[model samples]
Target: MASKCGLLLFVATIQVLIVAAAVFNGIRSGYTKVPTGQFNSNIDQILLGQNSIERILWDDFQKTPELTAFFVTENPVKTIANGAFQRTPKLERLGLRGCQLTGFPNLVYVHGSLIELHMSNNLITKFTREDVHGFTKLQMLDLSRNPIASFPDMRYILPSLKTFNMQGIGFNCCLPLYQLKHPVLVIDAAPCAYPDHITDRLCLLESRFRKFRWNHRLEIKAGYSSSLGGTACQEGIFGPTCSH
Candidate 1:
């Protein structure tokens, strides 16, 4: 009876060891090479055993050629940290809607390949010329619901920009019409109000009038006063001085 009991205990110990080995092997097999392809369906396969991605290193994953579009809905990835997607040359579309980003990142490196950028519902307050300068191929830029205050320069516009939505973004100052280089298909500058009386038309008129007086003064200095029709001596109408 004693021998039978010892034998049974020995069998049970072997079974436990075998089960443990199998479980360990299964776990190791589950972490095998992740495939790469265009539009990788296994992108979110590795959850890092957590609900959100705390960190993402491309080198750790297999590369997929079809990964042109990336949609990040995870709240923990609110702001795209610097160098997050810096080396992805083939990336074309990036959607970060509802991310709590406080401002726009310097994406001049990705401007060459990025076509559509959706950053709506963010906390961006400003856009510098260098921020959008290299995106010559960009088509759609959604900056709606932000806190942008001004358009610093017009040189940042890409030739392919078709849709620009700036609605709900506060620009407490005058909207510069000259900032638009190409004909925009749609612009949601609706909520923006003209804070002053100087519309584009008024500014143009003022500029042209100043240029005319400057030319008149140059002509007068060149002995062409006959064009003044003897009114050059009129009070407060001196050459170029009338520009004031």
Candidate 2:
């Protein structure tokens, strides 16, 4: 009986030691090397290469309060487990570009300190307003080269968003400009190859013009009156006359 009790205590000690080692490794991993391009003191650039499991070891991150930015691209995580960021309330920037994610992880929703999110070249189909409801400080979001057809109202929800990349989404006819509050410098608007492929997209603009709402009408009228140019509309040029 005495030996059994001693063995139990030894086993518990080993478990505690293992946990402590994991936490130490996770925190010390960031100090190995600094990432290239864009450095901020407020952000903690972490390169997670050893993590094979779906969840980020939140238990390790919680110990380091100063840690902010998470750069998990070197060894890109395939799937993020839920509650992965529960302890990481201070994390701001997250770079999961080319992680091969089909959907935004549940862990992302819990953190509110997120300001910049890089999710380019993922398998994400669409992002609704509710999916990103809590990220009030989000400024930069990259959703390039996804199958996203429907988009959330960017103007209403992500008011602070400055750079929005929807390059290869393949907008069929027209983009929903009515959903935007301010005129953002939208990249790759002519995904359908406007003017070049007239048959496919020539009448596309006309169809959008016919279905213009009150806000769209006001924008069109304002553009026509402005010194910028005539035949101006949200989807770049109004027709062949307005094509830049």
Name the weakest run of 10 consecutive residues (lDDT summed) in model 2.
211-220
True-structure lDDT of candidate 1: 0.49
How far in Å is the alpha carbon of 122 misplaced in model 2?
1.0
Candidate 2 lDDT tens digits, 1-244: 9999999999999988754443222322443332222232333445554333233443445444445667655344556657566766777787776656778667564447888888877788868887777777888888887777657657667767787777666554344444432454354524542223332121223553422212112332223322222333433433222332
**lDDT of each candidate versus the true structure:** 0.49, 0.54
Candidate 1 versus truth, CA RMSD in Å, comes to 18.6
Per-residue error for 208 in candidate 2, Å, reads 11
Clash pairs, candidate 2, are 44-69
**Runs with alpha carbons beyond 4 Å of true place in candidate 2:** 1-43, 49-60, 74-76, 107-111, 180-182, 193-244
TM value for model 1: 0.53
The candidate that wins on TM-score is: 2
TM-score of 2: 0.59
The residue-level lDDT of candidate 2 at 110 comes to: 41
